[model samples]
Target: MVFWITLDPLSDLSRPPGDLSSGDLLNQVLYVALYCLTMAKLIDLGWRGARPLLHPAYLLLLAWFAVSAVLGVNPGTSVRRLVLCAMVMSIVGVLPILPRTQRDLELWLGTAAMIVVVLCYLAVLLVPALSVHQADAPREAGLAGDWRGIYDHKSTAGPMMIVFLFIGAFLAGQGRHLFGGVLFVLSLVFLLFTGTKQPTALMPVILLVSRLALRTRSRLLFLALCLGALALYNLMTVGSAVIPSVSDIVAKLISDPTFTNRTGIWNFAIDRFLERPLTGYGFMGFWSTDAVLQSDPLGQLAWTAEATDSHNSYLDLALTTGFPGLCLALWVVVLMPLLDFMRARLDPTKRGLALLFFRIWLFCIFVAALETVFFLRDSAVWVSFLIAIFGLRYLACYPVRP
Candidate 1:
């Protein structure tokens, strides 16, 4: 888990002894190591221990992705992505069988968070060239300086810090006050250095809402309130004219009149999504295809030509796998865990895991609006999300004492 979370082999600062090709070779080796370890652990669990792994929603989602990949515009690439997804999910499948108690879970979470925080600080202080983004590459408007802090990009580092911040809070709630407080402060410092505006602005609100939702009468009511709030926000922001003051405030906070030029990318992606409404371009298929690069469908848009993704997970999923894919994702990734957490809420012994899953689910859902995290291979956010979903399923199948 630490190996995957740290992504050591993929880090620019930790390149292989030789050239770029050797680095790719090392990455492949590490991936194999990850896959073998996951499978071996699953085998050790035996059929009885692994029975919970047969989650209906998870299986159905993987099946749908398989079929979509088979019929996708880029079958080879889609299949590769599907395999990687399965590998990550396989590792996640072990979560339930591990962690015998809430303390066990907390220990793991705190350890991982500390490791990340320490590594980030080390990179910033000791290896500035690799940790920070250089001026050679064009940056977002208003981002005079940005630090990635051991991550490949500021965008990646910022979201990661946001996640660790929550993890730190979780530790504090678990009674590890000193460790949690230190992690919280460190994560905030790294987030500020990254200069990631939207996430920094949204983190406090997300944490507050998650805490409030946990106190609701039932999961159904919580879900309803969440959906209602989301709808209200959407209605208000659908057009600046609907609520000019609110929109203006948001724009100024992010300091990006065009959302860091995301609007143009979203528009182009939506147009492409319309082109293949059913079983869209395929998983990670739209951006790299020869046809797309040759035709330049986005025209002279400044950001679109150089962009690698839609920037919005929902739109990216829809563009890659269409509405059906999007529906499956929301069901398996979001709604299923939510439902499971709700069911677990009925059991006093299961409430801890339930709350943990709920908080992680809320964070993922919120971040997806601004980042491409859905099913993204090897992303810390996506991996953390899988942990939440799989952890919820684990508790549902094998109820644990709080």
Candidate 2:
């Protein structure tokens, strides 16, 4: 599921790293079809005794969608977002009432983590390898020398793996240390090999925040040691004159104003949003119509670059649905952590789930500041479902003592 969701965005499908087989496209469509069918089946079965779409979160999400439908610049895009939201909500709706004990909670989370691992592994197998030119740039090989595997962008892979890594790390803390440690290590290695700088920068910030939020006994000490070790690791890998020094690499990263010209796109989006402060461009409105995109700052900076959505999600939302839309979405995101903290007191088992979701959500938002996040499916969607599930599930599991 993650593979299909990510492949389009990450692959260099422009030139395509490998052969362009019709079979490949067929397989991709089939994948989506199967996933949708499975979700539908699950919802169908659950409907016999499942909760209705009357939940508050469902209402809020639906209201937001209706607004987008009426006001959205691109009804098609707005509709797509709405459908995705509905699918996710359905998943949340079917979750069995909250687990009665800490052990039950662990089982649920463990199942999810295992599924993530399996999906990522399958992605590694399904996508074909493609060789990219390295004449002026780094001649890096993708999943396989030429295979990008499931994802198109090298950057997305890192964050995707980071989420898994945190999940694995939490599992390790729960006493499945050996298995968890291995999973964590694999995820970390995958992130490093991707060579994407954002995840490299974002992961530590999340890790630090998670430790503090979890209020672990040795959090401060752990953070200091980890930071020191990370510095040393960078010194070894990127700093050696024999190799690329961290300083040299970081300087190069900073010098690239575009970060692929995302910054310019963000600025353009902001300006566009300012034009429609109350209900900006209708959903998916900004990119479609010729009037939608007034200028291409990205095109001016680079020889040939595709400027799709604004690089930033916040800007994208404002551009699509206006300030109200953006604010509502942001509210959904901001409330996750506080909700997690509250749930943690009721169910200690939920602590791990909360920590994992919190970390992923935090990084998603951090990445969103620089990158438009919704074009591809991501952790944000999954975390949102988890938030709704546990929020309702916990309430059902443990009624108020009073």
Clashes of 2: 23
lDDT per residue as tens, model 1, 284-315: 76665543654474566654445667777877
Best by TM-score: 1
* Residue 233 lDDT in candidate 1: 46
TM-score of every candidate relative to the true structure:
0.87, 0.67
- The sequence of per-residue lDDT tens digits that candidate 2 reaches over residues 109-180 is 556655655555565555333212122222233323322224555555566677678768877887878867
Q: Which regions of candidate 2 are displaced past 4 Å?
A: 1-58, 92-149, 216-260, 288-305, 374-402
What does candidate 1 score on TM?
0.87
Report the Cα lDDT for residue 199, model 1.
77
Worst 10 residues of 2 by lDDT: 130-139
For all candidates in order, the CA lDDT equals 0.71, 0.54
The TM-score that candidate 2 achieves is 0.67
- lDDT (Cα, 0-100) at 100 in candidate 2: 48
Q: Which residue segments of model 1 deviate by more than 4 Å?
A: 3-5, 8-25, 138-144, 218-220, 231-257, 294-302
